[model samples]
Target: MKEQENIIHISNLEIGYPIKGNINNTLFNNINLAGSSGELIALVGKNGIGKSTLLRNISGLQEPLKGQINYFGKLKNSYSRTDFARMVSFVSTEIVNVNNLSVFDLVSLGRFPHTNWLGKLKPEDVNRTARALEMVGMSSFSRKHINEISDGERQRVMIARTLAQDSKIIVLDEPTAFLDLPNKYEIIHLLNKLSKEENKTIIFSTHDLNIAIQEADKIWLMLEDKIAEGAPEDLILNETFNRIFEKSNLKFDKLKGDFKMQKSHHRKIGIYGDGPHFVWTKKALERLNFMVVKENESGQYIKIEKENNLCKWTLIEDKNIKEFSSIYDLSIHLKLQLKN
Candidate 1:
């Protein structure tokens, strides 16, 4: 497969806001990164990190403290505001005051950079706006007032606005901040689809690290001390998350691709089976602070077997066997046994 071309590149970039009198407070420096077309990149970090500031610098909303950024082979600082708007579109977390403006009207605002001084929407502009609304699955609600829609709908509308702008690169700052679980996944899925289908570069800052780990083509992990950028699996394999979120009580589960709080277990449980039932049974046992082992040498063992559509779980101890039809029932039995 051919490698995608780079849309934006940053070398030795320093990012932060300026201080009035004292030295400028810097969050990160010496950053080197590149984003390619048809890619979905997630900027993930803990709160108060510089994910937002880095996005701002890349999108040209603010000047970098030092170093250089190149957008489409041109200097980032060289483009006029209007010219830059044609290359990159930004969506912020700030709620818009939608006083009676319809969704279509809101999306059409993205075309203002290309419009004449009168800001009239040409036929092509109107068509592009409609397409953008459709792209985000909000075409049916194009005529609805922005205030009449839910928070998730508003977020989709904002994304549609960026689409209508026809920029090759799109940047969003915490777009899923106020959304529900399903909506958050939906928005990220939509962005992933758009990046592949539309061949646009989509970068969004998010606190949802799990979703980013699962969905993003590339992850830019910002830590208090450094920044690491790579494919999600590469970063995980390199144990980058472990280093970035180094904590005594936390462990990153490579199998589950999630972080878990360390727990103390007073008992160990042996499990037998090699299917979904066994997997879930192990999970349930672990939740109760029971360590799982493979062999029955521990004397206490749980066996799971599926016959036809029904599954049976049996507990064996001291040459005695007790069976239960469901894992829930088995769990209840274990709780009682542990208490005794």
Candidate 2:
């Protein structure tokens, strides 16, 4: 397959705000990143790491303190406002609660750059707007008022609006913010589909690390001193996440591809089981600060058995043995035993 062309590039970028004369409160610097057509890139960082600021800088909503941003091999400064809008579309995190705006009208607003001086929608513009609504699965709600839709549906409408703009690049700040779990996954998956099917370069900042790792073709990880850009797997293998929360009590689990609290174990317990039951039982025990080991290595142990498709957990300590039908019961029993 032919590789997609690079759509945006950043070099030596420094993002922040000017504090005083000849002084700037730089959030991060020396950033180098690139995005290709048909690529979905996730911008990730801890809270207050300037992820949003960096997004704004690259999207042309804010000026960088230093360095260059190029779009389609031309300096970003060279493009006129309308031309730039035609090439890049930005979606902010703010919720749209307009009481009277219909979904179609909101999405049609994206054609502002392409409309005539009188702001009239041509036949081509109307077709494009309707197509965009279909692309984001919001066609059925075309006549529905914006304030009447659920948050997830509203987010889809926002994305459809960008699609109507028909820009090569889309920049969103926390697109999944305030959405439910299913909605979050749906929104990210929709972005993934759009990037592939429409060949659009989609970039979004997110705190949803797991979903980002799973869905993004590339990731731009923001740190205090520098920004790291690469495939998600490459960043994980290089231990990049270890530095994200260096001063906090959170530790990234490379094997699990997620973060866990810094836990201290006071007791060792052996676990015996197979398949998912064993895996989940071990996870449950570990969450309670139990050090899981071989059954022969510990004085206390838990055994999991399946009978008629129902799971049973048996706990053994010294010469005492007790059985429970659920992990919750076993956990409670263990806690009580510890207190005694």
Candidate 3:
């Protein structure tokens, strides 16, 4: 198999904004990151941590305060405006809801860098635009007006526009920002597919760590002092996630690959069973500020039993024994008992 080529590289980079004369508000510094072709990279961090600034620098939309950005082994400054546009495409978080603009017309705008002065769409350009729409599953909406589609559909159209650009690298700033749960997953999944099938280098900044951890090939985790780059599993195993949220009231759960709130448990409860019922019961107990423990270690216990194709929760607290048909009943009973 051929090796994937590195398409974007940043070395000793500093990103921020100029506040006044000889003074700048640096968001981050000494940042070194790289992305290769056919890879989906997620840029994640707390809010106001420069994820968008870093993306803007990479996309050539904003200049880095100091350091170098290289594209395909060439200096970023070496590419002219048109050449840069042809090499990289950028999608911002802003939603486009222009009335009377057809999806086909919007996607065709991506071909501007390659078109003549009149911005005429040649046969090849039109074909590429159509193909881009089809790639994003927006071919059916091509004739639809931009304002007529939903937000998710509009986002797909924006991506199709970038695809039409046919750039080697694509930078997106919070592409899934205004989307619902399913749309968020769908957008990230679409990006994953594009990176693998189209072999495009895609980097997107997002606050959706769950989806990012699940879908991204690499994660650029922005820390307070530096940027950590690696696979999601690598970051988890090395406890990088723990460090990222150490200052907050959240901790990373290595086993679950997600963050959990640090809550105070007032009582200890043991839960014993097998299968999904046991798992979910434990979760419910934990959410109610109960520390789940081994059966032998706790006086209060909930035993999940299956009988006649139905599940029952048996609570044993001191000498009081009670059975509940559903977890809801068990939870309410426990809550009332603890309250008393």
Candidate 4:
């Protein structure tokens, strides 16, 4: 019924870097963007398309070439450095290279804006650091050396540091990069939870389009000349994703909310089955360059039968039938039969 309050706002923003003769080398221009508190936004684009540059500008690490940014209804430039540090926290893609930094000490660095000139940690600061570590599930590693943990754990520590900063907005660059599947999912899920449960505004750049579409509250899609921002479904419905990501041999599958490889095929095979096995069977058939049909309208048909939890695949063509107990065997037979 009520709109979330805007935490960050941009208008007619131009982002770029300076080159020879003080002329700006523009990467993107004429942009408008806004993000609300308690929102998770994902920024995605092809490599070298300025995703990182845009993020740096937003985090106040660098000045925008043109236009204005407002944080909490105030001009971003109005804040003192320490005051700005209290307003936003940034987690960069750069790897940590501390020789012997402990996780607790690293997380404690987030409290610098509130600490005394001598950098003394008060009781509240210690408690907040503990809570930040707990939020990222890294409390057990607090006493561990930063270099001793896995890359994924180090990433979580960086996030925990942001949490400890206690800023209203958090910006991260490629937080899931260099992580395995489980770690990627974990980090994405943690960010989503933090946005909702902690009531923090989060913006991150990522290459994981599938996770972004599924988990982010909104998406900031960086194009070659401009940026597009909207809910994931809105972008899909407007065909924006297709405009940006579609190619001759790949397509965005709106129903599956992911990309699918397209292929040219001359053979058609009808598949009849049910459940997960059927789904995977169809996938395998499609990967083999077969045009998979649902009914027996085609001359060639495959039947997937499940009995007592064991699986069987049968191929029917003309007056001949071939059966196999495993998908590998079925695939081998099909390859031999359809090698035209």
Candidate 5:
């Protein structure tokens, strides 16, 4: 949906976990994903579905067994470790090795790409590191050791570090796993805003299905034996969600935007106006299981209501009729009527 050159492109990628027990089994096959600048995408998949592996490949931490990866349209293998570091930064869910480092020092690792051979920082780099810490709300804790912070705080610190790196693309693996509900919302909101304000592409793997569905500009969904990627709305409308989660016991409800028991209920009421008033009335009625009916009001007793005006419906009995004057009037009257 965004118009820009691709920052990350994987053509026929193949990935597999390198854990000791099973090092040969690939998660999925022949995968392709493209990420553009300023886009926020959720990398989603069921458990053991290769979401992390996919993230690893994008961050250049792992190589694809087959196919090619292009970072900023250049082949990934062509870039040296330093070149890769300059182009991408990652926040992994795996245990961090930081312990003795101060929060400031930890976050300054992001500036590694911009430093000299001895990794000495310039005044400009210092300013960028400070700003990065400030962006993630960790400025006050800059002098504290990273081990002194809570898991969620450490997560923010990692994000700050990524900001300092100033890479064109950032890859986060399970960023919200340690955060509480409100914190998760805040972080996602911040990430969304940052992606636009900074004009950097952001891709993160997440287990938060609801958040992914609600906020992501695009989604890479891992299905059993396969993977799917596209805009969230497009995937939902095309029933890709149902297939991805594939469970008879749990199902996706398009309207509710969640997995629930499949159900069908009907409402049978009808009458209306146009514009905001009509639109809202229909929604309210639908919510209450009322079937809305619309009809012509030529010679009929039906009347459509507007501000400073009222219309009676001739189709139904006046005693059980639902009517409204105007959008504003209707809101007030409905609140008052429902309040008691």
Candidate 6:
């Protein structure tokens, strides 16, 4: 494959934690990477894998046991601290404490590399900070203190700070860890927009596989024994990725993009009709039983109905027709019947 004309080249990278008795410990090996400008890349792996370690190595916070990172045709190690700061900025899972400082104050620190010795903001700095705040939708809360914000809000503030740095590449470690589903998507969307609109490179680590596959321009898959990197959908569709995260017995399903497990007891249920009918019926059955199977039940007609500007579903049990608006409500009714 031809190398991207404008890429930040990182070669032969190896990173691991230090230890005395654990002499043979290492995370990954011989990693060569190039992130292009205006691309969104995702770094993903199991929990104990070295995703953060790689990010820190590139940020120069931790030195790799062996390797080199070149930024704009210069060795990363050769750049002065100020020059390094000017080249890239970072956001991690670490929480900050600037109790009295408002959002603008926190973001203003991103301009320090370009500001005077007294940390006075130039007009350019003001414009950049304002734009960053507005991009993250934190402009309305500019005066709000960091200490008095939600985790999701704090996250946006941190991204705004990285934007204020005005660097070519921004590295974030699990920016969506603290977010719930909606906030998670929102933050990812904001980062993607920033990368395209500002023509900056954005790399972040995340456990959100579905979003990663749908959104990332590139994906770096870190496994226990080997590492895989490509476009998010490419790595996913090539059958190289596996599901690693789980809940209480919620095993990963690489095919359906959900969790599945064996049934304690199977469901004796019949489904009829087509289109939306099967969806709600399947949902109701799944919620009511450990496992649901479809067969022709002798007398019940659980089928579809479409009314004026609405979709309706009805069940004919014991020669009576009962209607429902949502599958979840149907599930609740089925759950009651299962109990009895």
TM-score of each: 0.87, 0.95, 0.95, 0.93, 0.73, 0.80
lDDT of 6 by residue, 66-96 (tens): 7777777578768888778888899988998
lDDT of 2: 0.91
The local lDDT score (0 to 100) that residue 26 gets in candidate 2 is: 87
Off by over 4 Å in 4: 1-5
- For model 2, residues 1-340, the per-residue Cα lDDT tens digits are 2245458889898889999997999888888999999999999998999999988998899999999898987888799999999999999999999889999999999999999898899999999999999998989999999999999999999999999998999999999998999999999999999999999999999999999999999999987678888899999999998778888888989998999888889899999889999988988888888999987999999989899889899998899999999889988988887788
Candidate 2 lDDT for residue 36: 94
Worst 10 residues of 6 by lDDT: 243-252
Candidate 3 on 78-173: residue-level lDDT in tens?
A: 988889998999999878878899999999999989899999999999999999999999999999999999999999999999999989899999
**What value of lDDT does candidate 4 attain over all alpha carbons?**
0.89
Q: List the residue pairs that clash in candidate 3.
A: none
- Runs with alpha carbons beyond 4 Å of true place in candidate 6: 1-6, 21-24, 243-269, 287-340
Report lDDT per candidate: 0.89, 0.91, 0.92, 0.89, 0.77, 0.78
Model 1: CA > 4 A from native: 1-6, 305-312, 319-326, 332-340
Q: For every model in order, what is the number of clashing pairs?
A: 0, 0, 0, 0, 11, 0
Write one digit per residue (lDDT tens) for candidate 5, span 239-271: 988886676556888987887554343435455
- lDDT by residue for model 1 (1-340), tens: 1245548888999989889865789989989888898999999887777889999888888999999988887896688878889899999889986689999999999997889999999999999999999999999999999999999999999999999998999999999999999999999999999999999999999978789888899999886677889999998899887765664667788878888877898788899898788889998998877999867658889888899999999999879999999888988988997899
lDDT of 4 by residue, 238-271 (tens): 8777655543466778888777777898789998
Worst 10 residues of 2 by lDDT: 1-10
RMSD score of candidate 5 (Å)? 7.8
Deviating ranges (above 4 Å) for candidate 5: 1-3, 17-23, 261-340
